[model samples]
Target chain A: MTTTNLPAAATREALGPTLVRLQQNGANIVVVDADLGKSTSARTFRDAFPERFFTFGVAEQNMISAAGGLATLGHTVIASTFAVFAEHAFDQLRMSVAQPKLNVKVVASHGGVSTGEDGASAQSVEDYALFSSLVNFTVCVPADVVEAEAMVAAAVATPGPWYIRTGRPKIPVIYTDGPRFQVGKADMLREGTDVTIVACGLLVERSLRAAEALEASGISARVLNMGTIRPLDVAALEAAAKDTGAIVVAEEHLTHSGLGAMCAQAIAATTQPVPMEFVGVQSRYGESATWDEVLEIMGLTADGVEAAARKVVARKR
Target chain B: MVYGAQSGHIGGSMSSTEILAVLYGRIMRHDPKRPGWVERDRFIMSKGHCTPVQYATLAESGYFPVDELSTFRKKGTRLQGHSVLGKPEGVENSAGALGMGLSFGLGIRLGMRLSNIDAHVYVLMGDGEQDEGQVWEAAMAASHHRVDRLVAIIDRNGIQNDDFTAATMRTEPLDEKYRAFGWEVRAGIDGHNLEAVEEALAWARDVRGKPALVIFDTVKGKGVSFMENNPNFHGAAPSAEQFARAMEELA
Candidate 1:
């Protein structure tokens, strides 16, 4: 997966059209939005299938509950809002959808500090943790437009509750043409022996850059695009830990309970436990800033991942 | 069931007993043997804590074997403290956290329209459950979308888990609020009167252009003389002596 000549696009750009295409194919899909359909790309679905699309006008709790209600009637409901806005609907998704294993897919955009200029309130750094905490939920953070499209189709094809966080900013394409993507699986983009760099969502592109930089500095760091956060690919993680002996986990979410915390727990639970460093936001709120500035502030970049990879490799005995 | 369970919400259960009876016994088109019948009308118990009356109605309606009623609230039993979907077969939606039924019913009504299935969705709520902001949110959306055949019934027993709605959170004047939200208001009906419940439900089914709200005025505990309008009976189950007295009074 080379960086140059690859098309870059925001992850949400794929959501609505993908659903529209699926609906054309006779898929039983319902799209629910909390008055942010245009911003979240759900407007495309709403326009394509006006009868199946519903808007709750800035009320996320009702939207989620209604989505769950629709799911009970044999429709695959996809509810959309900003990631931070989803905080109000946590218990609704948890009880009505997740607990009962309903066929409701909650897809949110504007994730992380990379959601630039929207400020701290809009940036959802804790969304991954909040969604993954729910039982019977397939939590996902797509790396790029292609992965996001596949996740939407996969979520519709599968029957159960799903939580997918798509990025707001455009990033470099990481996959080849029509690459095979699966939910609850990890994609090993690069192979290395010194250390493993695991990342998700928009962080995958930066991790690839960090791996490239580390290769130039004679430090071979493997890059893994871990899209599915829950039902995590523990086997791949354990194999990576066994092979590399050190790892660096990075994401656009907080290091406290998102990818960083999951990876740490995976490493500790694995037979081949290894030293690891995390490259993500700590326990702090983000402010109004550009993507690069927010990344710099939160230490979530190629340089930050590279530095963490180096530190982890050094710590390995 | 409440006397046997020793932990069921007897007050609210007794309050909504006749309403549930009139629904299952006369109004709803549900099949006990076929809980997933496509054309059947759906009932959502949004105020989930009052499961004793709900379970009794379902069991009495033949949704499941009546003998299983004794296992209420016990370990590994299908009868949970709160209503859960698929627990006993006829249960339509899972509920416990208040103020979710209307939105859920709206979703069902919308789905029915999409599928071209002419089925009604009835959501039974509580007076105290109105305090949850999601109820108003759902109310606004249901009427805005003109979701017909979506009916909401409030068990206006006045008491909550421990106190009254007027004292805790003050969700007073529910009829005006629902009317403003664009629902047909049918207020001040006796919930314990089986005929009134039947008439209100019949009126709600014909409500076109928008959703309908039926407010039932009732006592917290309707059967037992000692527990009637008594707030202490909200969550607390009756002791053996009190249960014996209640049985004699109902008999």
Candidate 2:
């Protein structure tokens, strides 16, 4: 049932419709919103299943905690809000949802500086780091609409705590058909041997583009879409490390605690400690700009990823 | 559990004794053998530090062997220092943080409505827990949804961890707050009086359109002489001599 007619759509834009489809199919889904349903697109679900929908009216903490409560009653609870706002409810998530490993899925939108003109406060550069740090959390950031929809379905099929981050701005669709998504598995978008570019979120698109650009310059780079950050595709990572001998991690988050750090840890734990370079926000906050402009400033560009890929490739042992 | 484990919350545990007794013994529709019974009612201890009261109640209610009380706070024991679901059974949800249980109970109430299970959810909280903003948030949401199947009980024991709840945070006019939030309020029931506790609960279970709040006024340490209304026993375990004296007083 995967479609080939692709459009440039925001990952968040896919949440409501996909959620509504799942609910119609008899998924015991209860969506708890914090008054930003229109923006997060939870409104689509509200329009469909008003009775099952709950709005906590800007109380993210209550929404998050109540999702835990509802999940205990055998409902697959999906709580939606902007990424930055979701961070404020980390304690509730830790105490109520994560500690108990409840069936609560926090599908946060407007992740990273891709939120554009909203500036520093609305952007979530630390979400993957924070959510993944929790013991039972499965943090995932899809590359496009198809993956976003599939990711939501996968989360419903699976249990325990899940944090799914989606971007506000519509980005290019990389997958023409939906790809099979396993929790800890990475998808190889492009095969190579010089180096492997491990990236997550919209950075997967950038990393793919970087690989294309790298091929023209005689540097053949492999591209891996690291959608699931926690319980990372260690086997794929190990294979990439063993195959290519170098890795470059790209993400729309902080360089310190996000994708770069996870890949580094994965590589470090193995005997193969490949040379790595990070293409992300340089431990600084993002500014107000167009989505593309802000991402460029934060070094989330294809060219930036290409440069890191080459740099790491050169340092191959 | 405090005396057995040598570490646990005793004051609030002692304070909530009769309330737990009334619910586990007479009220809640539960079978110790069928703790996960779909039709059974729920009890969530929001003031989670009071772990032993509910644990002991569950044991006496036949959820587990009464002798397992000795392993209350030990490592790898299902009887955690805070309330958690399963192991001994009958625990509906894991709760340790204050102000979370009511919202949890609200979810259960709403879910029960969706599934048409027709079971009540009772959330026990501390008076000091009213200071948590999430409590007020839950209070508003419960009334907004008008989930009559959810009953919130506040063990208004007057004292909290360091001192009295009045000394720490003045939660006066508590009934008015619940009323304004559209809850049917039954304030100031004598918590130690088992008959009074049952009467208030019997009334709360039948509330028609709004969620119910039954406030029980009790002392922090109800059964012992020196520990009564004493903040020092909020979490500290008694020495052997002090334990003997407390046992004597109870006898």
Candidate 3:
């Protein structure tokens, strides 16, 4: 089906309210929070659906465990908290929730260094790797507000445990009016043969800009919005490898075991392996920086991605 | 069912047996055949070290055949030492970790509440497990949510893994503590007495505004003479001769 086009203006800041609306429409849905409902833009759900909304009073483990119970009872449970504390529920997410394939959505707000001011301790730079290590977790990092809302709706409706990494800042709109947000499929922005940039979360826009820069330098660059990190789109990765010969994975997480590592492993498991560069935070803690500074320091800026793409192209066969 | 077997947590297990029997026998609305029935009530063995009792009760309740009790704790046997999730049937979550089952029960209960399913979630925790911080977390959340459909039964045999509960970590006035946390507390019943167990459960069933905690003050190894109130048997399976003696006493 040709994707229906939505005006970008309508999608720019639609994530928070849209999620609230979708959840309101679904009777079986409940939102659990760990004292950050307002920051995560879920305060409306708490206010409107007082009975359906549960506040766990800053206890992430209890919140997740309760969500697991709610899921078993057949409720679509959405547990929202900052990304760092959500990691505190990793054991519950793995043992109680994912192992049983319980239908619960762990909506982690303030994901990545974009959280700012709270510094490294609060930022979940390693969340993707942590959740992806589990078997039955669907890790999603939506780049823009529209995708975040769409992904939230999809996550609540989807089966099994979902780890949705959302941000605190209002990101620019990318997919306005429903631009084909398939769970395991990659959103190809620009087709190229020389190099491909695989990215998710806040890095998608930077990757797109990096592609434009590469084109100016006479390089044909491909940009793939890799939303689902756990079930890494191997088919798309393989197609990019066969078509592009060079690839760069950009994420707002540590380079070790996040989307880059999953892509690396998937390509290694396949017969065809492309020259790849992983653009993300190196193994280090976060610091107090503006989103721009954090992106630049963590090598997630457009220039950083462009440089990484150049290296990949240089290493290509 | 396996009366002659040497087993651990016989005291705590016997104390909780009637509670389990009531749940599996009547209180819990679950189907052994379709264990994952969405509308079915959930039961979590929070104090999971007492598997001999759970296996025996499960067998008696026809979750599996009575013959399966013979393979308890043996390697490759479905009857594991702690309750595992992927077992034959009647097991919900893998709950070897202390202070975890209650939280898991809370999750299932919350899920049920969200789905608008009128199913209750029951979790049986050991008196010793009260020391775990997560238990308090779960208790606080359960009470805060006023989960009327959630019931937590503590096996208050006053024994721990190493010694008496007082010697290890006292969790006395357990009823008061849970009440302070917002659970409607009930006590003064013989845990082994089927009639009292049914009565306390009926009370818990009637609760609407708060979670219920039934503290079963039972004797460790109630039926067996030599092992009665013995902390050594908290985790020690008896030898063949000891097992025979215990079985004789129980019979």
Candidate 4:
């Protein structure tokens, strides 16, 4: 599939419109923000649906538990905050939302090092792992504005707990309008046979660039956007392992318990196990820098993904 | 039920028996046959460890068979050690961890008010459980939003797991603390007195435009003489001799 050349837009931009659209369509969507509505762009939803919006005033725990309560009353609840602050309310989310499988949508923004200049304290590289470990959660890291918008709509219509991680910086548009976004499905951005480069969130754009670079060097690299981290698309990973024989899993999260670990587990359980390489932060904290500078320093660039893809393919027996 | 379980929070359970009796028996508007009735007032036991009182109230209110009280914490029973939502009909929220009930109750009240559902949310929390920071967070939010039709009752038994709450975490001046957080505080009421508990409930319902809290000054084990204010029975089950005496005292 051809990539959309539209200008880069922050996932939060799409999130605002998506929430408004769902509310306009008569969805009983209530938004709760923990004083980060401006950053998470939940302010837009609050503006459109002021009556349905609530400001929890910097209390992430209260916001999450309140979301659970709203959900119990059959309201489609969207709780928004910075990803790092979400850790404060993990127990509340685990008990009130995940264990009970409440219909609460936690749309945490500023995921990973892309939250430039905030330093390690604000960056959330382990949120995906933390949320995915919950028993009944649909964890999604949207690849671009389009996918983020679609996933928010899908999450609202779908029941149970959901955690959709969006980034702070604006990333290139990877898909056209109305992408086919499912809860536990992976989107194949490109199909190939030599090697498969799997990625999610902002890294999907880098993976696409890496795939193009690999093709010029006579390597047929496939790109798969593993959006839903929990309830992973194991079938797609198995198919990729069977076909490509080598895989490179990339994400803007920690190497441990993130998408790489998830893919490794899936491949290990399969009959045909492929050589795999991980492209992510390797057990270190991030510092203040521009998004691109941090991505380069953390080895999360397209060159990094391309190098991992070649290394994995060379290790294929 | 506590005797049958052989292991339960009998102390705190007994302390809140009158409060539960007042709410489930006469105060709250609920239909036993229709536990999921939309118009029913939502009851969340935030201090979930003391679930024997809630289970007994639920059973007596006909949400489940009265005989099911024998299955408390037993295998193949809907009544677990802590109460869970949807396990037995009418249990609004699942809770074991402390300090979350008020927040959950605030959310339900906000949703009901926004949707024009016309319902009240009652959250039962323990005085010892006030140590959790999340409870204060919900308290601030509830008062900031001026969440009406939300009633928070604290089982202020003055004791926690190891020792007294004042020694454990100093949660005294609770009424002032709640008032400082903007809640309408009702303090120093006899929790064992059914009439006093009912009067407090009636007064809390009339105080509008903000959340109301009724702090019941209660004994840890109110009904039975041997267990009253005794920290040993906080989590300990009664033995045969103790159970016989406790049954006689309660009777």
| Best model number under lDDT | 4
List candidate 3 segments past 4 Å from native.
Answer: A1-16, A23-27, B1-11, B26-41, B71-80, B84-86, B107-119, B221-232
Error of 1 at A174 (Å): 1.6
Model 1 lDDT tens row, A167-235 = 788888777587557888899999999999999988898899899999999999899999899999998
TM-score of candidate 3 on Cα atoms, chains taken together: 0.89
DockQ of 1: 0.84
Give the least accurate 10-residue stretch of model 1 chain A, judged by summed lDDT. Answer: A172-181
Question: Can you tell me the DockQ of model 4?
Answer: 0.83
Q: Write the per-residue lDDT of candidate 2 for residues B1-251, one digit (tens) a residue.
A: 79878988999989999999999888889888887789999998899899888888988989889998888999878898988766557777777778888888887888888888899999999999999999998998888877887999999988887888888999889999889889999998999998999999999988888899999999998899899989999989988998999999989
Candidate lDDT scores, in order, read: 0.90, 0.88, 0.80, 0.90
10 residues in a row with least lDDT, candidate 2 chain B:
B85-94
Model 2 residue A148 lDDT score: 92
Pairs that clash in candidate 2: none
- The deviation in Å at residue A309 for candidate 4 is 0.9
C-alpha RMSD of candidate 4: 1.3
Compose the digit string of candidate 4's lDDT tens values, residues A1-317.
55446668888776777899989998999999988888888999989989999999989998998899999889999999888998789999988999889999999899999987878898898998899888899999999889999899989999989999999898888786558778789999899999998899998989999999899999998999999998899999999999999999999999987999999999999999989999999999999999889999999999999999989988985
Candidate 1 vs candidate 3: the DockQ winner is 1
Distance from true position, residue A179, model 2, in Å? 2.9
Which TM-score value belongs to model 2? 0.97
Error of 2 at A266 (Å): 1.1
Fnat of all models, as shown: 0.73, 0.61, 0.73, 0.74
In Å, residue B155's CA in model 3 sits off its true spot by 0.4
